[model samples]
Target: MNFAKPLPNYLVKRYHGWKATTYSENQVWYRRLATEGQRPRAMVISCCDSRVHVTSIFGADQGEFFIHRNIANLVPPYAPDGDHHGTSAAIEYAVTALKVAHLIVLGHSQCGGVQGCIDMCKGQAPQLEAKESFVGRWMDILKPKFDLVADVEDSTDQARQLERQAVVASLENLMTFPFVSSAVEAGSLSLHGLWTDIGEGGLQCYDPKEGKFSEV
Candidate 1:
């Protein structure tokens, strides 16, 4: 495919403006981050949703976190497959190579994938065809928990429960990785489950002691 194209006027201006201020205003940060390859303290596995940006939420600058984003932010149990494993590979690098101190599985409210999965499980959504959609296969990872927690009396309640279940399920699956397991066992690494509500602007954390998520 033919490549060069005129830059958008606004983008060109923004790029030049950033460049002008970068070395003087942002030099200290750039120097520190560039001194070494990424040496992040945490790795965040988050949804591919644009609104769910991890670094911005945590006010982190470059190289502060090793991030992996995918549809629904699901971490499927490690398996040898020919298919792309972008998220898995990110995890491997962060845990084994970078040796991040913590791993956070970040899930959020109003997650379309989780809602779609709930609808599919309740027979309200269209059946999946392998040739056309991996929805069925992707959500299959959350099936049992969704079924266990489905709200029979209220549809809205069922949706809320499904979102929560997704977070818990992913956290459990995260530990299935041998590196994660070893780190947790040796107290070198820790796992945290977090849920973000965009509308509420609240960050709730899962509390195993109370078996419920509480506001952070």
Candidate 2:
């Protein structure tokens, strides 16, 4: 805590401005959310990319969405090892505790995490290939997907294809959670996969019937 000494002046000023503006306008709503706890309608699993703004893109109000962000927006197959699984923990909390109606996995183009996986698979990243690398181990969930898109001739195109597959992979993995699958089968929960093109600001939704993402 000592390293986090004083708050920056600019951030302090911005906090004050927000407190006076949005916070003041929604004072009653904020109070209600605090007292009654959150009942978010949906849980969004998205990449930890600054360019992918889930709330802003969806025009969501505070507490409306239970958002979880991780590298490449991936979800490993349900593994209850009792280890420190941050992403799995968040997913468990959202599905079992929050009981969100919709669980959406959001992926994006030009994802660094996906690119890292590609590099690792091609033996371009020795660091990621090491057993001690946390990121490399985490991205192992995505290594299988590389083969799914390996036919693409272009490297960048292959990366983009892999990125989209990450969403589909997460959706499939979500069903691996017993609680999540039961909820879905009971008509209490639904699953969705989405991809975004940050450079063009385009959004696409995966069509299970069509087996591809189309503009939304």
Candidate 3:
């Protein structure tokens, strides 16, 4: 398949147009962003889904947020594995290097990656590839949550539970990192879990009082 040939020509042309316009009108802001290294006050760990954009949702511009996105927006427990740990590395940079004060785990409703966990728990797992893929392996971290919530009353409720659980679980994982834990202990770092319902345009905070998600 000729991938390049399949793209709509107008869409590709617009990128060049945007690049030129940004260079012209936003020159001062662009120069400042270039000169002053990124010093984002908050960092967000979110899903790679096109619908859940951290910058757009937060109404942030360039150099505003240091974001790390993955399938289901996971953060695994810290370990010195001799492998490429993309999420872990990003977390390290955000905490140790960037020194961001707040870290947010942004989970969304109807997440496909969380659904993958639900499917795996129900014994209808997706087929595995020969080599370990990142999303597949990361979803395993939430396997226990899936197993615990698999028999919930409603399918939508089950999925929502899984999403919130994953968010909390990832926060726990963030604490597993020594740098993050140290900063948190010194009150230099704080963590939060948020669930955004795209359909209703509602933002919910993980409420400890109700031990569940609630509207903000």
Candidate 4:
């Protein structure tokens, strides 16, 4: 098949840089990782947004985290209807196959997906309201959160609240999976919710008892 386009020149340069610096420095380690399968201790579910750097935030090595990124970092409620559910499939693989100890839903400030949810719910984004829009349907998981922060007057504040709410919502949805629930109940797995302030470079962790996000 004929290719549509060549790899971007900037990305090609970046790959060459990786091959020179990090790859050269960690040749043996990289080879070992290639030979031996990855056994990540935690799975990080984050947004597809380029700004949210999961690896950079944790200063993680290549195999340290099994990362899954999707628009808005949302995990919809488990339906088990035999449809294509990428997030759910990843979660199942992580919990059952990887046996990761922690499943972290990492949300961030100024998520376009969350904003889209806000707009679509408020009749601002008609395109998102359409049934055929993947982003719109994906954002439906977070749409229910707008009501949680309905009283917040400021738009940014509302988006922030919804972002945190998205983390909490994904946590709840993860528990809906039988494997996740059983593993959690049997003490094999733990769930955590995290929200990051992209501009301020601050991290806030969810406290279920306080029902708020506090800076970490």
- Clash statistics: count for each candidate: 0, 0, 0, 0
Model 2 per-residue lDDT tens digits across residues 1-216:
567778899999999999999999999999999999999999999999998999988999999999999999999999888888888888889988999999999999999999999999889999999999988998999998888888898998898899999998899888999999999999999999999999998999999999999999
Question: What tens digits encode model 3's per-residue C-alpha lDDT throughout 126-155?
Answer: 562213665567788888677668679899
Query: Residues 1-216, candidate 1, lDDT per residue (tens digit)?
Result: 569889999999999888788656988778877886678999998888888978878999888898888767788877657788776788889889999999998888778888778877777777642435776778778778876666556866766667777778888887888887888999999889888887777898888789788889
Q: Write the per-residue lDDT of candidate 4 for residues 114-159, one digit (tens) a residue.
A: 9999999889999988899999988988877788898899998888
Identify the superior model by TM-score, candidate 1 or candidate 2.
2
- What C-alpha lDDT do the candidate models reach, one value each? 0.81, 0.93, 0.86, 0.94
lDDT of 2 at 117: 94
Regions of model 4 farther than 4 Å from truth? none
Task: Write the number of the candidate with greater lDDT, choosing between 1 and 3.
Answer: 3
Best by lDDT: 4
Ranked by TM-score, top first: 4, 2, 3, 1
TM-score, cand. 2 vs. native: 0.96
Please report the candidate that would top TM-score against the real structure.
4
Clashing pairs in 1: none
Report the error of model 4 at residue 32, Å: 0.7
Better model by lDDT: candidate 2 vs candidate 4? 4
